[model samples]
Target: MERKHELNNKKVLVVGLAKSGFAAAKVLVKYGANVIVNDMKELEKNQEAKELINQGVEVHCGSHPLSLLDKPIDFIVKNPGIPYTNPLIDAALEKEIPVFTEVELVSYLTDAEIIGITGSNGKTTTTTLVGLMMENNPKKPIVAGNIGTVLCEVADQTDVDDILVAELSSFQLMGVQSFKPHIGVLLNIFDAHLDYHGTREAYGKAKARLFMNQTEEDFCIFNADDQEVIALVENMKSKKVPFSTKQTLPKGACLNEGFVTFNDERIIAIDEIVLPGEHSLENILAATAAAKIAGADTNQIINVLKTFSGVEHRLQYVDTVEGVKFYNDSKATNILATQKAISAFNQPLILLAGGLDRGNDFDDLIPYLINTKALITFGETAPKLIKTAKEAGIKVIEHVDNVEKAVPVAYECSVSGDVVLLSPACASWDQYPSFEQRGDMFIEAVHKLR
Candidate 1:
């Protein structure tokens, strides 16, 4: 693909030298933009910053000098992780200069259509399902964003004829200005990232940006059962398509008698779906809606639905030890997520729960723990979690400093038929860097039992 000339002769500031920022800076340089890359990490430690310097782009390492923006700049390309509260970002906004993420830059880089998906949960599962559904299409589909691959990394390789399937987050979606996906898929929303977003309403408002720039020609598929999601996008301009698990919708995707359907056309039996939980069922319905709209065959849709087990770290079954099974659902970083994970099991459950204390009351998750064999809590919120379990009449409860210790405790506590589950209902920031790392520890601990 030819370089986009729109950025030529433009002075752009690329903030935060992470993957997204590095990718965006390279793309900008390719388009003849005068790129100045900024990061707080020292130059000796930042390989990406060093690479930018070698490419003739000015590198400002160890700090984001406001002086870098003192010169007239066309716009700022920011890493999605860089918050709006960052002084540079705050300064850019005050100057009326546009600040965007790599996802936005990709929207400008290519004329290809986009299929964007975002939710408090289920975004990865639904996005992966939709990408699989579109993978066989003759037009070609690329899966990127939030699900590991940065959007702009795939942008230059695509053309107007290609389609980009993106798994977006509130962090990514919150940065969009003119960026718009051809098809916007909004899964269920819940209270999340309150530390960053500040309020429940603010978080919802950030999520609502998935449909912000959509036009009449674009499509908006959302969860009909989520009153909060529905309430936010009531006046969206795009064509509204909804998927439901509670009741059959006259339009879009719906569940009826265990069969997933789209506009009354049968797709697959709910039991045939290899992924567990009613949330996964809802994801299938949502994915089917997008897949059918993308012109996937009914037979192909059914095949994928039956074969797709799930994404990693979300309700994933690890190896069993001496007749005791271990499951890794470290992706359940919130109370609602843990609730969904618990609902997927019927076996005797010995649950491992807890994480960073975000001031969340786990009261909502107590009902789901009624018949569990035991509850093992860990991380910063262990005491709070133990109290919740004891109050709910969960007989056996234990607390650990982290998941590394929780695993061994769970192993010793589990009987022959019991399932030891690690589904921490809070973020892993209190101990581990990410939920994936926490899940990895659980997997490592289980493997060590041999």
Candidate 2:
């Protein structure tokens, strides 16, 4: 791929004033692109907005009116937080204006190698792991996208030989037109972000598009354990390479007899991955598959795999006080994720669960609760969760509206050898700014109990 010399003098509308939005605006401005930014709040109220203004970027804070995008524009760069169905985006489309995500925009301008990764869970972990493995290749890879800074900012400062390991979300994948990668890693897919995508099928379609744009020269490393992803290979026309924890793949990576095997000649024992649980094992398999396909040395891959620490907020251990173990799994924003956390624990659990509901099915979680000694529900989803648990013949206790009330009740109910886990199976809009904030509050409340 060849790099473009300049992106100057083109009008680019950057929507959403979040972290990704700020990074996109900064990168576009640096490239001499005419960048117009918009957010649904005042500049003084939104920190990112104020920062962009200080950088001399023109911003329309407090709403994206039709007039904002009605003018002539080269392309519209959007943040993942803004849904595809937004009226402003729709209006831009009606006028034949092109809309690209920050990821797509970055891909268009860089000659750097890209390793795109997407899944319902462990995308951050896998993205970070891939970056670590590539560090041995002498490229000194940069991990970005949904995990940290936007990809364009990383590319702006990167040389032609550098590698980009991107953690792409379902929303980010939607705006991409032809953002193909040299190595594409598809981790296990589960029900997540249904509200933005509208349905499970729609969400899965967006994720599947990551591989749809790839060619035979590129590699699509998939999770064989996920039926949804594997099914896409059977129907799609792209180059398909599958990996799994449950079965062996003929081309990609898989677990066989307690070993992580991938490519055609590379193999490692399950212990080589050295992650926390079985789910993390799957993440390692997917990452190893992508790295091996990209020509990473087997020894370098194993060394990086063993040394990488897991990402925060996903099954994070808070503290152990007087034989009670507490975990902060605020990243489990869906029912299937909470189910995975429950399977990882063997002892009786005092599970603290709830948040802004996304119409999640509670039936899958009832068996885990029945095995537990006590269940405490909080957040706006508490009543709905309690009702569903009761229908499944499980007993649940309700607390006040937030984690502050629920954490103490869980602490009181926990006994020696019992675990108190906060793995809300819904979004955090009810009482927090983001999942990170929710996880922080849960950790702080647990500390207060100590």
Which number leads on lDDT? 1
- Which pairs clash in the backbone of model 2? none
**Candidate 1 residue-wise lDDT, 354-411, digit = tens:** 8899887888987999658799898888988888898889988987777888888898
On the 0 to 100 scale, the lDDT of residue 373 in model 2 is: 68
Give lDDT tens digits, candidate 2, residues 241-329. Answer: 78777776677777777777775565667666656667788788788877776667788888877766566888888899889999988
Best by TM-score: 1
Which regions of candidate 2 fall more than 4 Å away from where they truly are? 2-6, 234-239, 263-266, 271-273, 304-309, 392-396
TM-score of each: 0.95, 0.92
RMSD of 1: 1.8
Candidate 2 backbone overlaps, count:
0
